[model samples]
Every structure is written in C-alpha cells, then in structure tokens.
Target: MRSSVKALREQGVWSVEFTEAQYDLLVRSMVTFLAIEKERFARVVTVGPRAEELDAIISGAERVHGGKAVIRTSLDDIHMIHSMLVFLPTLFTSEEDFVTRVGFFKENVAEVAAGLKRAIVRTAVDV
Candidate 1:
C-alpha cells in the first residue's frame, strides 16, 4: 500500500484504485506528508535574528516580510494539502465510501466511462 501510495505520489495522485486498507494507508501517508510539509513551511518561514537588539529590531520586519512572501509562494500547496486532508473526507457519500473527483474528472474514470459509453458516443462531426 505504501508502494501504491508512493507510486500515486510520484505519478501525481490524481487517481488510483484503492481498497479499504489501501485507502487507510493512502490517507495516513497523505496526512503524514502534509504534516511534514506544514512543518517544513513553518521551519522555512523563520528568519535568523541578530544577537544584538539594534540589529534584531532593524531586521524583524524583514522576517515578517519574508514570511509573507513564503506564505504567498506556498499557499497553493498548503490549500491543496488542506483540501485533501480536511475537506475531502467529509464529502463521503452513502453509495460510495470514497470519492475520486479532484479537478476535472473522477479518479475511477474507467468505470465512469464504461457506464456512460453509450450515452457519450461520438458523432461523424468532431469537436
């Protein structure tokens, strides 16, 4: 399952097949990765202060400014992680234990396509 998650991660975890056990592993791995990322973000946002108060006072705003820049640079990753870890789980439906929809399409696209094949037929004229 770890390997599967790693594969999904390496390939970009837009979609993948997962059993209950694999889902658990994926969630754990994602949460762990996101935690590590959050921690790294926190660590990276800090600016070193000079030992002397004179220098420290002068550079304190630099730290805040740097943090703002870092936050702007990282907001997308943070939002993506947050959506995956927090908002995603709450959307579990009664029929489906999990959802595969993220951006454009469902993760279980093969199944979806198969189900809709007849309805989604192509005509002589192309788009």
Candidate 2:
C-alpha cells in the first residue's frame, strides 16, 4: 500500500478518480499525518512555500483535536491537501490510483493515530 502511494508521489502533479469514501480515507490520513508532523516539528515547519496553508490546516486539525471531521474535507481542503505534504494520487486516469492511495492510509491509520497521540502528549506536557 505504501509502495503504491509512494510510487504515485514519485510521479507527482496528477489526479485520480477517487470515490467519496476513498477521498475521505486519504484526506483523513493525510490531514492527521500533516497535523502530527506539524506538531512534532512546529518551529521548523513554520518556514516553507506552503507554510501558511499548511499552518492553517494544522491549526484546524488541532482545533478539532484531529478527529474524524478532519477527513470530511471540502473541495478547497482537497485542493490544499494536494498542494502539501506527500501530495495526492498519481493521475486522473483511473480509480485504481485513488483506491491505492486511500488503501495506503487505511492500512496506516493506526500508525498515524499513534503519531498524533504522541504529538498531543508533547503539547500537554508543555502546557
């Protein structure tokens, strides 16, 4: 799963025919991943071409406390996610790529959840 997703990321700058459920999974995992990475490295992450947008996303994710709603993204959120992190599907050519991407997330959600938990733990300790 991760291999296919990584392959799609390798190509870059593309789209795929993703169903709503697939989009939800990808969006959820991507956002959660971004949120944790942002939290785990907030200071350095403050700088980048897409910093502001990514910051805004992480902020929202934090506000929701990185809940399921983070994955229930709008078109704008989808576009934003496309521009940041590992990026999205490889092409708009088929649903297969989309399914592969989403499957990658589904397969890795527990990992993302653990990372997110650690991130939250760090913040709580500091607070």
Candidate 3:
C-alpha cells in the first residue's frame, strides 16, 4: 500500500475514490493506531520531549473521529495518514531512535492533520 501511494505521488496523481463510509473507517483506524503509538511511546520514554506533540496529534485525530473536524477526501491525505501509521512503529526500536525521529513524526502528523478544522467550515458553507 505504501509503495502504491508513492508511485501515485510520483505520477502526480492526487485523486482517489473513497466513499464517505470508507473515509470514516480510515479516520477511526488512524485514531486507533495513534492511540496505540501513545502507549508504546510512554513505555519507551517515561519522560521526554515531544510528548505534547503526540497528545496534540491524538487530539486532532479524535476531533476528526468525532466529526468535529473534517478531512478533505483526497488521496494525498490518505497517503499521508497511511505513511504516518507505517512510520510510527519504526520509532520503537530504541529510545534514541524515538527521540531523534519524533520531530519528523510530529511534523508528518501535523501536516496530515492540518486544516482539518477549516475543512468543516468550508464543507458547511458549500452545503
């Protein structure tokens, strides 16, 4: 799935078809994954920086899960979410790795979750 998305991105194709139901499932799955990551992170690093960033990512995912935020039904968004999910596990190999890679992790989450709140307003106006 990751390679397929990368290929699509390389081809400059940003559109993908996903029913609203599928989008809902995707968001829920993402939230679940992040929640699991939180647990792993806590175990790996009892106290550390970037913890708040993880919390913020979870909050963003929760907002989207609860329909308080809207996700643009774009393939790029799907790719990003998938990429984050895939990348998160790599951080758990060691504490040092997690610390070093967390900034990148948070960046990806923020980028993927960015503007989700604004999407809700735009969608409502369109409707």
Candidate 4:
C-alpha cells in the first residue's frame, strides 16, 4: 500500500484534480465502504501511514494559514481495503479510467489520512 501511495504521489500531478467538496465526499464514501467491508469480512483493518506523518503535514498547513483540512489520516490503513471492496466497483468507468481514478484517490486519501494521524499523534504527545 505504501508503495502504491508513493507511485500515486508521483503520477497525481497528471491526473484530474477533484474539488475539495468532491474529495471530502469521496473520502467519506470510501470510509463508509470500508466499514461495510470490515463487517462483511469480519477482520481487523490496518492503517497505512503512521499518525506522526499526518500530524506533521497538518501542523505545517496550519502554520501557513491553510483552512481546516478534512483529510482523515486515521482511515489510511483501511482505505485500500475499502477501496478494493466497495469504491472501485461503483465508480462506473472504463477499466482504464477506473484504474486511474482509483490509483489517484488512493494516494490522495492516504496522504490526507497520514496527515491526520500525525495531528492526532501530536495532540496526544502534547497532552
């Protein structure tokens, strides 16, 4: 998953950019799909990126006066699993576009989730 994320990060600049609202909606949907997969599969999910990495990104964004970033890093470990089981099939695209979009959002979600995890960790560390 980490390797896939790294590849997406590299290829993302060339892909379509989704609006913030779209991104949020996609993430939320992906998360819900993940929950359903967990229930159906009856197994534990792993978070991909570490929380500390997510926190560092958010902290930097805050310093730059970025508005609230709603990327949910806490959900990374399960993003891929959920994506595979739920989101991918429903995208309704040609195999090429579906593959492209999946790779693109997978990375986007992972990066966001990693940042959120970092923020979560930092808050915990400070307390």
Best by TM-score: 4
Q: How close is candidate 1 to the true structure, as a TM-score?
A: 0.22
Measured with C-alpha atoms, the lDDT of residue 56 in candidate 2 is: 56
Q: Please provide, for model 4 over 1-127, each residue's C-alpha lDDT reduced to its tens digit, 9 standing for 90 to 100.
A: 2211111112222111233433443445454445444543332323233422322322222111222222222234324333333333454446555445444444444454454344444544554
**lDDT of model 2 at position 20:** 35
Q: Which runs of model 4 end up more than 4 angstroms from their true locations?
A: 1-39, 43-104
Q: What digit string (tens of lDDT, one per residue) describes model 2 on residues 35-100? A: 444554442333334444544553343123223223333334434454433333322245554445
lDDT of 4 at 94: 61
Prediction RMSDs, each to the true structure: 18.8, 16.6, 12.8, 12.1
lDDT of 3 at 48: 36
Q: How close is candidate 3 to the true structure, as a TM-score?
A: 0.28
Query: Which residue runs does candidate 1 get wrong by more than 4 Å?
Result: 1-15, 39-127
Pitting candidate 2 against candidate 4, the one with the higher TM-score is 4
Worst 10 residues of 1 by lDDT: 1-10
The TM-scores of all predictions, comma-separated, are: 0.22, 0.27, 0.28, 0.33
Cα lDDT of model 3 overall? 0.39
Q: List clash counts for every candidate, in order.
A: 0, 2, 0, 11
| Best first by lDDT, ranked | 3, 2, 4, 1
lDDT score for residue 40 of model 2: 40
- For candidate 4, which ten residues in a row score worst on lDDT? 6-15
Per-residue lDDT of candidate 1, residues 11-39 (tens digit): 22122223344334334434433344344
Candidate 3 wrong stretches, greater than 4 Å: 1-13, 39-127
